[model samples]
Target: MASERILSKVAEEQKKHALNVAMATTAAAEAAVAAAQAAAEVVRLTGAAESCQRFRKFDPNLAAIRIQSAYRGHLVSPS
Candidate 1:
């Protein structure tokens, strides 16, 4: 039956189209995940850099204050 043959062909084409659509969707999802991971990595690196900068700025000031406090304590505490 010619009609049956045509129907089978149409079904095969439909299956191929469906598979193509699924592959495209999977590719898009993978790309989105990769982009998000890259962005997260950038944010993590930036935060680390900022924390290091803050510690570098704070350490010397903290040391100076501690020295000053020790000197004052030595003068004020009666032995």
Candidate 2:
């Protein structure tokens, strides 16, 4: 009868350990998912910034050409 009592106590401790392990695993998985989501957001924001920078690039030659074209047009037209 004492052995039966000891066996029951061992089984109870095993159940508690299993529950703790399951909880730890769940927390780790949630942290991993959050990290992945944060990484994806960084990638999205970086892509947007790069695209905007591309459009904002300057071209001095284009500016000069546009100014010259306007000046020629003005010189040839009646004042």
lDDT of each prediction vs. the true structure?
Answer: 0.68, 0.66
How do the predictions measure up, each by TM-score?
0.62, 0.63
After best superposition, candidate 1 residue 58: deviation in angstroms?
20
Best by TM-score: 2
Give per-residue CA lDDT, model 2, range 1-79, as digits (tens): 9999999999999999999999999999976865665556556655654566554367424434544555455456663
Candidate 2: which stretches are off by over 4 Å? Answer: 54-79
| lDDT by residue (tens digit), candidate 1, 22-78 | 999999997686566555655665565556676647564543454455545545666
Q: Return the clash pairs for model 1, or none.
A: none
Q: Which residue runs does candidate 1 get wrong by more than 4 Å?
A: 54-79
